[model samples]
Target: MQNLQSFASAMSRRLLREAGNLPALSGNDFASSKEIQRPLDVLSQGSGSFSAFPKSNEQITTPSLPESAENVNAANQLSAPVTQSADKESSGSKYSNWIFVLIFPAAILLILVPILVCRKRGNASMGPWRTGLSGQLQKAFVTGVPKLNRPELEAACEDFSNILNTFPTCTVFKGTLSSGVEICVVSTSISSIKDWPRSAETLFRKKIDTLSRVNHKNFVNLIGYCIENQPFMRMMVFEYAPNGTLSDHLHVKVYEHLDWAARMRIIMGMAYCLQYMHHELDPPVAVNDMRSDAIFLTDDYAAKIADVGVWKELADKAKATKEDGSSRSVSPPDLAGNVFCFGALLIEIISGKLPETNDPDCICIWAEEHLKAKSYSTLVDTSLQDHQADELEAICEVIQGCTDPDPMQRPQMRDVTSKLKAILAITPEGAGPRLSPLWWAELELLSMKSN
Candidate 1:
C-alpha cells in the first residue's frame, strides 16, 4: 500500500511537469497551469487525499484501509483512459484548425479568380466597344436602326420593280415608293449557303446599324430597310445619289471639265467626311473601299461618298489565301490602313488617273518621282487650267505623311483635317496663282521690243 501511494504521487508530479513541456502545434500552445490542472483533476477524482503520501517501509506503517485502497485502485484504472482520450482530442482540434487556416483563403481565391476573368471576357465580346470619338453613341446599334414590316416595304418597293445592279452576295433595285421617294434597294442573295437567310439577316442588321448612325449631307442616307419572306429578301434602302458616281466625271468623261478650285473643294469635303466618321463618332467607322467609283457627284459638283461598308475577314475553307493575299480569317484593317487608302485617293485626285494604271506598289513611287523633280505642272490634269506648285506641294505633304510605311509616323485624321482647313483658308475661290511683279516687268520688256 505504501509503495502504491508513493508511485501515484510521483506519477502525478511527473505528468504536471511534462504537460508544461509539450510543444506548440501550428504556432498555438495550450496554456500550462490551467490546462494541466483540468485533465489531472478529472483523472484524480475519487483517488482520496493526493496531498498526503506514506513514507518508505522503514516507518513501520500498518497496511492501508480496504475502502481507501479500493477507491484508489478504481481511480487509477480510470485515469489512464481519460488522460489518453483528452490528449487525442486536443491534438485533433489543433490539426483541424491548422488545415482550415491554410486552405480556406486559397479555396476562396481559386473560386473568385475564374469568375472575374470570365466576366471581363464576356463584356469585351458581347458589349459595345468604347472609342475615342464623342460619347453620345454607346452601342453600334442604337434605337434609330429600325426593323421594318415585310409587307409594307414590299408594297413600297413596288414588288421589285426594276433591277439597278447585280452582285454575287446581293442585288440592287431601283424602287420608287408611292410617296415619290426614290430609294436604292440592296437585297441579299441567300441561294448558295446552308442557312444564309438567318446569317444574312445578321449582316443586314449590322449594315442598318452602320447607316442609321451616319448623319451627314455628304453621306447617302439610309431611309428604311425590308426583311421579307415568300421571297426571303433582306434589303436596305438608300436615298438615290442624283448624278451617279464620280468615276463617270473623272475617268469616263461624262461631265465637262472640273476646275482646280472645284476639285479641291470636293477633296476637302471628302476629308471632312472622313474626319467626322473617324474621330467624331464613338467607336470610329473604317470604310475599306475608297476610290473614284465609290464617290458620287450631285448637279452642282457636290461630292458624296457612296458604297461605304465595313470589311470583315472570314475563314474560307475552299481557298488557301484570298485574292488580296490576306489571311483566311479576314478582318477590317486598322486605322492606319484607312489612312493609306486616303493616300491612294489623294494620288488619284492629283494625277487624274486611276491607281490601277500602274502596279499597286508603283503608285506611291510615281508620286514621289514627280514631286522630287519639281515638275509640278505634270501633277495637274490636262483638263484643269489652274495650277500652283506651292499649293500642290502643301497638299502633297499630308498625302506623304499618310502613306508612310511606319503607322506610328502617319498623321491622324484630325491632323489631316486641320492641315487641309489651313490650305483652304489661304486659297481663293475660282482663281489660279496670282502673277508676280517679275512677270509684269518681263511683259513690259516684251512690249517695248515689239514696238
Candidate 2:
C-alpha cells in the first residue's frame, strides 16, 4: 500500500511538469505569429516607410503548438496579414490618384489663361485709325465757317495764325457781305501792289465772287476788300499767315529756318491748290499769274495761293479789245504765257531766288543752264545741305520738268500735285527743313515795300 501511494504522487508531478512546458511553447508560437504579421504590415505602408526597418536583426524562433488550435490560428493570422496589407495598398493608390486628378487640370489652366488674355488685349488695341485729306479739310472748314464778320473775320485770322504758331495747320476767315452773305478771307505776306487799276478792282471783285463759290485749303479765301479812293490805300482783308510767305523765306539765311519738312509741306500745299483750280473746278480756274508772290502762307505755313483775280481782269481786257477790233494795251501773254510764268515760279522755289525779270538775263536762265549740265547741287537751296541727296535730286528733276521752256512739255498742276503728294508720303514725319523767323519778319518787310 505504501508503494502504490508513492507511484501515484510521482505521476502527479510528471503531469504538472508537462502542463508547464505546454504553456511556454504556446506563448512562443503567439509571439512568432505577431512578428510575421508585423513584417506584412510594414511592407503595406509604402516604399519610404518599409525602408526604415533594421535589416541586421536576427529572426526569432517559435515553439511547436497542438495540432487543431495551431492550424486554425496560423490560418487566421496569415489571412489577416494579407487582407490588411491589400487594404493599405488600395488606400495608398486611391490617394495618389486623387492628387494627380487635382494637380493636372490646375496646371493646364495656369498655362492657358495668359495666352487667352493676351489674345483678347491684342484685338481690343487694333481699332480704327483716321488719316485722310477730305476728312481733315471738312473738319477744318466746319470749325471755321460759323464766325464770319469784320471783327470776327480778323479775329479768326489772328486766331488761325496763333493756332498755326502752335502746330502746322491752315485756317480761313469769312467776312460779312450783303446781310447774311459771307466771303472767305486768306491772309499771306507777298509782294506789295504798287497801284490798283480800275481793271484790277473789277477783276478782284469778280474773282472774289468766283472764289466764294469754292472751298479748298490751298485756294485763297476772298473774304472782302477795303477800297480806298486814294492809291496804295486800299486794303484787301484775307486770312492771316502766321508763318508768312515762301518768297521771303526761301533765301539762304531764311531758308535755314524752314527745315526741309516745312519747305516740302509748302510745295505740297501749293501744288494741291493749283490742282484744284486747274482740274477740280467746274470751269477750271486758270492761275494766269502763278508767282511765289501770289502764293500765300497759312498759319500752319502751308501755301494758300493768292492773286487769282488780278490776272483774270487783264486777260478779259485783252480778250475784249481783240473782239472789238480796237488797239489793245501792251497785254501779257495768254494761258500759255501763264503756264510759263508758273514754271518760272517752280524754278524759283527750288533755287531760292527771284524769277528773272523782263530782262532776258535772269536767275531762271542761269538755273536752266546749270540744270542742263546735271549740276543739280547748284539748283538746290544751300540751306538744305544736310538733306538726302536722292530726295534733292528727285525734286530737282520735278522742278526741271515743270519749268520746261515749252508750255506743252510742262506738267499740268494735277501732275504736280500727284508728284508732290507721292514725295510727302515717303518722307518721314518732321523730316523737312525748319521754318524761318524770316517768314514772320516778312510782315515788316511788306510794310516797308508798301512805303
Which lDDT values do the candidates have, in the order given? 0.57, 0.49
- Model 2 misplaced regions, further than 4 Å: 1-204, 225-236, 252-256, 308-338, 356-361, 426-451
- Candidate 1 lowest-lDDT run of ten: 311-320
Q: Which RMSD values do the candidates have, in order?
A: 21.6, 23.9
Tens-digit per-residue lDDT, 402-423, candidate 1 = 8887889998888987888777
Which digits, one per residue and each the tens of the lDDT, describe model 2 over residues 283-318? 556665566756766556667677544543544553
